[model samples]
Target: MAKSKLSEKEQVTEYIQKLDPSLAETITFLRQAILAIDGEISEHIKWNSPSFYYSGDMKPFNPKEYKRDILVMNLHRGTTILLVFPTGAKITDTSGLLEGNYPDGRKIAKIKDLDEAKSRQKDLENAIRNWMGQIEK
Candidate 1:
């Protein structure tokens, strides 16, 4: 298929395929695992990394609020993968997978490698679900 005709997820596939070999596998696993949680969740490249967001309808809000954005991967650090939740302060996550306190209402989930990502997959999904449930629809 032509690149312009590709779906957002197909674009996501292309983006993942070009990732650093070490990070690609783990990120791919995460992309699959996250998409499995809910059909409304979709991904695309944002901030130069794989970004997941809720495509379902919700009460309208300012775009700068980032209410629809579920998470964005922060791969700039290279060695570890950081899933940054823009409005994560709203979710009360007890799974311990999510940590960090930012005044900007962000929370981060850290995964160092594929093994750790697999082990923490459930917690990650739970955190995602927790965020989804709090959505204003």
Candidate 2:
């Protein structure tokens, strides 16, 4: 069968569907919540994972700038899912949920499942919003 062209979100959803059930559920929840944050947020497959980009006034992401501004999820290791900020944007984390204290300013929020994701949803969205502002500048 010829593979039909799929929208980016569809492509990502397809990728998520292949994951272990628990991980898939967590990623799905995160994807929906992140997209709900802003209408301008767009996503695509980057580094073999679902990556989100904010295209406010700036030009949409080019291949060269793939790492410049992105919110990506890492699910390669195991049941634990990682929300990674590759560009090292300084995001607000009043809840102190984000880890990775690298000097480069990169950070990540580790999420285990739907419940944990729900608990940290507000913090994650706030951090993402702050990160978006950082990239806009």
Candidate 3:
């Protein structure tokens, strides 16, 4: 079957749909989580992939820019950091999740399943909060 050429938003929605059906709920949950953290959050297409960014901010958060394999969330603040998946997952510091590989020899955590994705969500949120706090400090 030929894959339809999707706009950036359609592509992202389609990617989420292709995940385990159960993950559909997780994707919505994550979107809400991101929005709740910052009301200024907005969506856009970057590098032919879906990305989230803050209003007035020059950078967008994209978790799929490494070798273009694992999905990643890039948060830019005072210190720009990339939150990669399980094998490339940098937040957990543990294994058992999805493995991530970077084109540049950088390893990230792979988000194996919905559960792992949720855990990563928490970590990402915490990191965002910490980053904001640092700016205030």
Candidate 4:
């Protein structure tokens, strides 16, 4: 059963906090990244996970329903995809991407270095834009 009084995004954030303190920074960065991509993007919790959705869309693409929207960008996005940082997970193959160990094996194309992160920002923005374009058609 879902916990009462907590929104989906809050639940996801609380889950991440339980996973590791280090992840707090990462989660914050991710939230900011999502906001940067689309100023109008809306955030919410879905299936106990934090989800960023396009504003005005009634559909809440939870982790389970992400496949329906190819542009949602998450772990389900094939090999090269965004890695969702679930509590207590670890990322093993973080070679050449970042300088630290990600507790979760989740692999997100999002990186940390200022320059690389900036590039990733562009990639993410473009992906969202493409998805929005399709939705508008």
Q: TM-scores, in order shown?
A: 0.94, 0.85, 0.45, 0.49
- Select the stronger candidate by lDDT from 2 and 3: 2
Please provide, for model 4 over 46-116, each residue's C-alpha lDDT reduced to its tens digit, 9 standing for 90 to 100. 54445666565544445553422222224232223343423112223223332224643232454433345
lDDT of 1 by residue, 1-137 (tens): 66467788888898888888879999999999999999999999899889999999999899999999999999899779999999998888888888888999999999999999999999999999999999999
Q: Spell out the clash pairs found in candidate 2.
A: none
Q: Report lDDT (Cα) of residue 29, candidate 1.
A: 94
Report the error of model 1 at residue 107, Å.
Answer: 0.3
Pairwise TM-score winner, candidates 1 and 3: 1
Candidate 3 — number of clashing residue pairs? 22
Candidate 2 lDDT by residue in tens digits, 42-126: 8888889998987667645565544455578888878788888865446667788778887666788889889999999998888
Candidate 2 residue 122 Cα shift, in angstroms, is: 0.5
Pairing residues by index, what is the TM-score of model 2? Answer: 0.85
Q: lDDT tens digits, residues 99-126, model 3?
A: 3455544443334445666778766566
The runs of at least 3 residues in candidate 4 whose Cα sits more than 4 Å from the true structure, single-residue gaps closed, are: 1-4, 57-81, 84-119
Angstrom error of the Cα, residue 96, model 2: value is 0.7
lDDT of 3 at 103: 54
At residue 8, candidate 4 shows an lDDT of: 57
Which pairs in model 1 have colliding backbones?
A: none
